[model samples]
Target: MKGGTKKIELYDTTLRDGTQGEHINLSVQDKLLIAGRLDEFGMDCIEGGWPSSNPKDEEFFKRAMDLELRHARLAAFGSTARYSDRIETDPNLLGLVGCGAPVITIFGKTWQAHSKTGLGISDEENRALIKNSVAFLRNAGREVFFDAEHFFDGWKDNREFALDMLKAAEEGGASRLVLCDTNGGSLPHEITAIIEDVRQHTDIAIGIHCHNDGDLAVANSIAAVMAGAIHVQGTVNGIGERCGNANIISIIANLVLKLPETGASVRDLTQLTSLSNFVFEILNLPPDSKAPYVGRSAFAHKGGIHVSAVMKESSLYEHIDPALVGNRQRVLVSELAGQSNIRYKAQELGISIPEGGEQIRKIVNHVKDLEHRGYQFDGAEASFELILQKELGTFTPYFEVIESKVYVESGIGGRNVDQAVLKVRVGEEIEHIAAEGDGPVNALDKALRKALIRFYPEIKGIKLVDYKVRVLEEKRGTSARVRVLIETGNGRTTWGTVGVSTNIIEASLRALEDSMNYHLFTLKATEPKPAAEENH
Candidate 1:
């Protein structure tokens, strides 16, 4: 490859470092799933996990070795051998090599404080441990990556000693020398200078490992790359010790979308958002909407002026086209709505605002009033679309609002008398479904789905994926209002809808109704036409 044409390698350690985050644990199967997805996303290396630390990681590395990875090399990670131990007899080194990974990463102390205090060893002994561990892995026919733990703080305290450690790893045949910001306190300028100084001393490939304690992991990692680092090491979703590691999702999205002139083509930048969501979903964690590039609100505009400008030309407010990172621009409807905002929102819902001069003003005023009373249409797009449908008289009921009744009977004696029954009518059909669950909400969801399945068999496949309930404080004493957000999903797609009322059950029901209606509405809109149109 030409000098400027070389692609920076993305080395993802999510499975290893990410699992270290509190309350986040991945099973062996989960690790494999993540590894597969990362490989599919074109990551250069998937640091499967530290085999020496856990059986699950050992199993993952062993199983990963048998699988055919197209774009990712499976790497096993571990720390260097104990200070007094020989490399030949070190169990950590033996386990890492035995795990069957073609690549192994070993971390060692570079900070003088850690060498003397944490490891209780002299500086010379720490350097020897780093060199011997790297040499052992390299001699085992495995590519070795040496992580100079706390290299940033180490360089700040003892620059000469830190550079000496890098030299030791290089002489031991380590493939790459990774400078880690273990404390995550280094700024971009500091990183740039350190990388530049290291480049002047060594010809070895340089890499960066960063943490997000200061929320600058991504910035510092990018700075290191700009300063001549070839590999960027981070975890997905920025999950790691302390705040987290550099977010590979954000880094990749920024590099691919904002720096296209750098001679690197990330042709699949469109997959970035979905991939980020996928990893978060697998971890069963809520995604941060404000995360750069791939977040939900990254392209959302709610301010009147901003929305108007964005509606006119998205580039006016958007830093980069959201579509480049698998996202789309979202014009949010809020209290700050102008006439342009109202018109654009209406247009998005396929609702044509009559050319009358007063129509836009009326809609904008109504939107503002509703928002002032605690209606957040921006986060509830499905409900907003429903509003547009009603305004345009474009919404027809998918099924008649059949009377729904629920009954419950509890056992008084030894006889089994406890029972809950639900009945509903849709169009000409009357359906009765009953179920017992831990709560009324659970029972209601089951009964509703059962009844809807009679008229729409597709309802059987739809599931409530997420449900959130918030108590509105206006009616604090006797009739406190509640807002419910219900996220429903078929196997292929998901939609979110919100409902508000004094009664929590009533709010949940309304949201559930909207969820089903939105699914049916979108389904019909996207359905294929007749054979004649298809042929044409």
Candidate 2:
């Protein structure tokens, strides 16, 4: 309803193109999970994968059938028939038909250089490939989409051939003609002009797919939309081959919030951030902290002046209300934190503060002192919460450590194991526990958890997902100060906690303690107070 007569369509290719990214591999189950999320996010089309390409993709298609998708049409992707075979006899094209998907996408070389060198085929034969494949899929009652790969480059080298390819797809009964900026080097102006030229020559609906090699994929996608292209094809978070594909999250944000007349319809915009994180989590990759709309630092303020202004009027610093996309605004506490930052952070943590200026000043000064000692709270909010709660006189220690030790040995059978012994006092009871692990840190984690699990059984739900250590001072050599950052997750949610000390084990222990305490705090907030706590 917002944009003009052109109804914009969003096509997600995360399962197809996104897996092409380096170090990105998704199992069939992972692909199916993402497909469901995309359907719920209201994408008009979801490219499942290339069924002919791999067994994983073929298995994904088999599993995706049982999904109860509501909004999106599933598409199977493949290239045109081989130049040496007829369209009906080509195994790749037959595989696409056998995929049982309602829609099919076929791509063929449009660039002359690729046609001659990449495929070793003539220019006319390439056009036939596009036409014959599209016609065959259409005849089989599948919604066929023809992707003219490298259309922009082909148009630049020989404009006539590129235009002829579009005509061929249309005549071959393709429901849509997609112009792919596969190399992602075209600027916004070039995309707009070429789209306008394509529109002048053909009346069929057009789509665009762009890579991020030039960091202009999003810009070029929007430019094409403005120039009357109806469909935009991209991967979530721009994860694809080379530099990646155009980020569909950024494109949706710009279209629905920034553009006035793009005629784009987005459902449940609040799920944008959650959807972005879901994909990242499935891939076991950390979410980008500075991503355009859904990142952790997108609307976070750390400067004193900025924090004060944002507290008075959020619009003073932020472009949009972060909640619109399920992201929350954060006031980071650091050396630059002012009184407003302290108050806002305290309120978020549900801490009660007395009406006094001296207390907030003391907390701010204490943070500055700790920062000077190489402690960074900006990225570790859980540790900052504990410090704030302590300074506010409402802190309670979950457990008091009495002593801990580690022992290592190599067995006679060529097996090695590290053992840790820990003693801790929970309220009035002392618990001694020992556990074996692959390493010192892991053994310590196991032993500590064993000591506390009986009293606080919720601790069993938490697991350490990431651990990073940094030496702060090289001059001290083995005695150098170390900083440890630990990321913990409870199967559903994750948090980061930090610790620093001269001893590496001590630093890790501090971070590990903070991680458990944070988990306990969250659990207490949701569930009833434990019966064991009443005894204290």
Which regions of candidate 2 fall more than 4 Å away from where they truly are? 1-3, 396-438, 443-466, 474-479, 487-496, 513-536
Model 1 worst lDDT run, 10 consecutive residues = 414-423
lDDT of candidate 2 over 1-536, digit per residue (tens): 21346678899999999999998999998999999999988999999999998999999998899997899999999999995357889889899999999999999888888988998888788888888888899999999999999999999999998998888889899988899999999999999999989989998999999999999999999998988888999999999999999999999988888874776766799999999999999999999999999999999999989999999999999999999888999999888888888888888878877767688889989988887777878767889888888788766779977898888889679788889888889999999899999898899899999999999999998999989988889888998898888889999988888889997787888888898888887677678667998677
Error of 1 at 309 (Å): 1.3
**Candidate lDDT values, in order:** 0.82, 0.89
The stretch of ten residues in a row with the least summed lDDT in candidate 2 is: 1-10
Model 1 residue runs over 4 Å out of place are: 1-6, 260-267, 396-465, 474-479, 489-494, 512-536
The most accurate candidate by lDDT is 2
Instruction: Give candidate 1's TM-score.
Output: 0.85
lDDT of 1 by residue, 415-524 (tens): 33322355666777777777655466666777777778867776777888888887778658547887888888898977788888887776777787888888888878
